[model samples]
Target: MNNIPFYLAAFLVVLGVLIVVHELGHYLAARFCGVKVLRFSVGFGRMLWKKRLGQDRTEWAISIFPLGGYVKMLDEREGKVAEEEVHRAFNRQSVGKRSIIVAAGPLANFALAILIYWGVFMHGSEELLPMLGAPPNGTPAAMAAVGNGELVRSLDGQPVATWDDLRWMILQKAVDHESVVLEVVNERDEISIRRLYLSAAGEQGWEGDALERLGIRFYRPEMPPVIGKVVANGVAERAGLQNGDRVLALAGKEISSWYDLVTIIRDSASRPLRIEFERQGEVLSVDVVPDAVLERGQTVGKIGVAVAPGPKPAREVKAFVRYGIIEAAGRALEETWDKSVFSLVMMGKMLTGEVSWKNLSGPVTIADYAGQSARLGLDYYLKFMALVSISLGVLNLLPIPVLDGGHLLYHMIEVVRRRPLSERAMEIGQQVGMSILFALMAFAFFNDLTRLFNG
Candidate 1:
């Protein structure tokens, strides 16, 4: 709750930047095509700030609504044009020029995404390796006999470099295939193939973690149930627990390992527990109520204790991934293209009922993600922004009325027919487009509220 203000600020920054980039595309393209831009607004509805600038005296404005913005050009269809400035009107431009102006907005968003990805890739960051732990019984991973501490090398012959790569490949494949073959190398250096069934992936409507549904998890090193550190003013500190204390049991059940203690604590949120431990050479007990906190939108118990340091793992669990300037630029282009295609595929699936519409996220969900990514670090925040930029670009390019793509569509038709659509027809198309957009917004908002309450 205390972070609400920070979250709002982050969301605003993301929205403001993307909107400005989008509108700037149209503004620049219009100016290049000799059309006069009357206003360049960062938002809609009642104007809050305005300033006239440039030789044409274009009104630069900010408005109340934050969701979107516009670059209004001087069009005779919209209003009267002076005889001297008639040649500079948007309607006087060629079809090719109009199409370029309409398409530039979405293009700008895509360019921004590519630029962000390029910078992040070049700067680099630590990423998790695609290492698998023991699969739970009866899951697809178990059926494939996936071993603990197995590093994924490839999925269905496609190379897998990091955990992110693995997840993305699996999602792409699972959308169409009932099974995927994974090539993995175990700790013993033995490489093998594992055919994993993914029929459930489709049935689940892609709602939770895909890896969890398949019983695939990251490797966790086993350690003893000893306290390495106790957080100040936390539940452990309040209960008189200290460093170097070996946990003997919790609520009369023997604590065999650190994981066992964690499982108990997580499932016992806000519940009182009797903790028995060994302090020095003597045994003692303490009563504590685990603190309930929201983690990833789920309520979990925490004792504010740190895991004791143990021996290093035999295999690397993380990798620092970076690329050279040229490689990073190439990879950035690929990433942008791949994500844009994936977004379109998901939307198509929704229309076909192959995927759930609940997957659609609203402003609230986006704000939540912005806050979380910002908290993670600059690399993650930039990646999140890049992803949102791609989404914005793809959405605007959709052939729906009132969107950039819709304007391009009109221009395309004009090219074919050698005439523009009637004013009444254009207005009707705008109305229909607005109605569709509104319905989608309503559904997305409902989904957001559902997640908030359910979580």
Candidate 2:
């Protein structure tokens, strides 16, 4: 409940940026191709804000719907055109030019992704070292004899500096392939090869906790039970708790680690807790009533206190990934291309029944991802935006009517036959395309609902 406003703000920012850039691509391309744009909208349905701009007097608008936007150009197919403006109509353009205009939107998304990746790479972040915990029993990691204190050196021959790198590699392989060979350095300082077989990975594998699917968990350092920062007006603050207070016990139970304290607090939502702590060598006990808050549809207790800072490692364990300008740009392009190709491949697999349709996601899933990434930090949020942009590019290129790719398909046919499809044929294509799109939307929404309820 406390983070809802932050989450919504993050979600809206990501959606607005992506949607505006996507529509701007079409708008620019249409103008360049000599098509007179009638309206450039940042959303759909009822207009909330509108203005006429440019020599063409294009009706620029911001609408109520935030899901998508469009650049509407003068089209003879859709409506009657003025005698003098008929030449500037979208339908009057050459097949090549029309294709360019239609394809520009997705291309813009890909370009945005490349730029985002480049920026993120330039401003690299500190990442946790790639250390593996013991694999769960009967899981692929366990079957392969993965150890608890081993450090991951690389995955499939690609050097991994951090857990993020290793996680991404594993997910990419799992989506398209069935196995991954890992190179790791054990605590004894011996290097060995371990193969993790993901043959059981299905479409549903992509949703939820991916690391859990692989039977892996991040190793967290144990922290002492001590109060760090207390939120203003929170239960901890109201109870007169101060920073640096060492919590010795909660509800008459000894609390050794921060994790133990968290579990106890969460379970005691809206309940009074008798907390014993050491402050300046003085032991004090206080009865505090935790505030109840809704967390993903369940009530949880929150004292609004953070963990005290821990000592830094003797040797720097955090890894940073950065590159020179030229290298970063090249890597950015490569990453964008790879992400786009992988997205397309996943869609194909899903269609072929090799991947589960349950992997499909709707706005709820996207919103959750946006919120999670934003909470992670700027670099993570940028990466998430880049990944989503690539997906938009790839999905828009699919040969379905009413989409950019569908229009391109029509253009190609027109080039070969030297004539556009009949009006009736186009109408039928639109109907078929609409049906397929609606079905996909329904499936994605259903999966989202299932996730919400199950979670």
Candidate 3:
């Protein structure tokens, strides 16, 4: 099935919600500060919908573009205000009040992230075991002699309970250091310390996938070649295969596990293969021609059958993380703070050329991730949203022009000087800020397309 629709919808949902939430913060702050609000706009360009409401008759609007939004308060700087309404102008407010109104938008984004994290922590998530797979030759994990079945115990003396913890620790390390010392426990209950070095190349931590650079992967248990569900009207079903059928052999070769069956099928695309199976304790044989499917750049065969559900691990491969409301709130706060700081540090790295600009992502990548996370479940989707929200908050706080932080910068200058900059100076700053913002957008978009084509 096509995923375009799903991605489009997900992108819209995520962007729309974030923009509205951000603007609402400005709107609320403006109202509380006794400013006259003229318009609240979600998205940009031509108005698709509008309504005037509240005591101020504020015109609420939804517009054509979903890329950005704003809240327009009545300000004397923008235009002349009537005598009676001059007190309600945004420009008439004290510097402190004006700054609060300006800062609220980005702060709202941070608050949203905290709330989402709180909800997710309260609900809990099923976590994977922190087992490490054998690293490829010449990689950091291999260089460290990281063994298979070694459980990641900690990173830099910090206890890491799951892959999430490990990833967070690695990201934080990337911000300020060239390497991290990992502590792992082997199958023999022996603990070892290993150093993992990072590179700006396609080495450790490329494209934000720390595992690939570290040469570590998830370790899963063996899977038997028993069919779970045969796709309706698929090759396997058409060939009379049934659920619970144990695949015995393929093309006269014995099939030991699902891995073996998959390998054979992938290589036998559009070709006839003899499949021997056991159903109801009776042996049967079927001639199946697998459907050819394009994967990556090659054609692969798929029989439309999947392995049966495996048994839950016996206390070694799974973890569930949850907390009571009070505990969850504290954890949520810590989580938000950690992620925010990590984001800021990473941005600093990118600015200083320590990190590649290719790591920057645009709407296309965000949409794709949104769809994938949604498919994973609500918990994953919420996590993705929270992460994005935090990023938005941090990005806006950067002292760049044409952004919230840029406005804050102007206000800060005004504070010390006790007067606003000249209109001409403000205009020049706006032009510079616009240039920087557009350049960043272009880079992000270019990176997005590059990943799409290469991937």
Best candidate per TM-score, number? 1
Better of 1 and 3 by TM-score: 1
User: Sorted on lDDT, highest at the top, how do the candidates line up?
Assistant: 1, 2, 3
Query: Model 2 segments beyond 4 Å from truth?
Result: 203-207, 221-316
Report the CA-based lDDT of candidate 3 relative to the real structure.
Answer: 0.85
User: Which window of ten consecutive residues has the lowest lDDT sum in model 1?
Assistant: 199-208
Candidate 2, poorest ten consecutive residues by summed lDDT: 199-208
Pairs that collide in candidate 1 are none
What would you estimate as the lDDT of candidate 2? Answer: 0.85
Off by over 4 Å in 1: 230-233, 236-257, 271-288, 295-298
What is the C-alpha lDDT profile of model 2 across 111-195, one tens digit per residue?
9999998988887778888888766688788888988667888889988878877776787888767788889887678999999
Residue 35 of model 1, lDDT score:
93
**Top-lDDT structure, candidate number:** 1
Cand. 2 TM to true fold: 0.81
Error of 3 at 29 (Å): 0.9
Task: Single out the weakest 10-residue window by summed lDDT for candidate 3.
Answer: 198-207
Residue lDDT tens for model 3, 106-132: 999989989998999898999876787
Steric clash count of candidate 2: 0
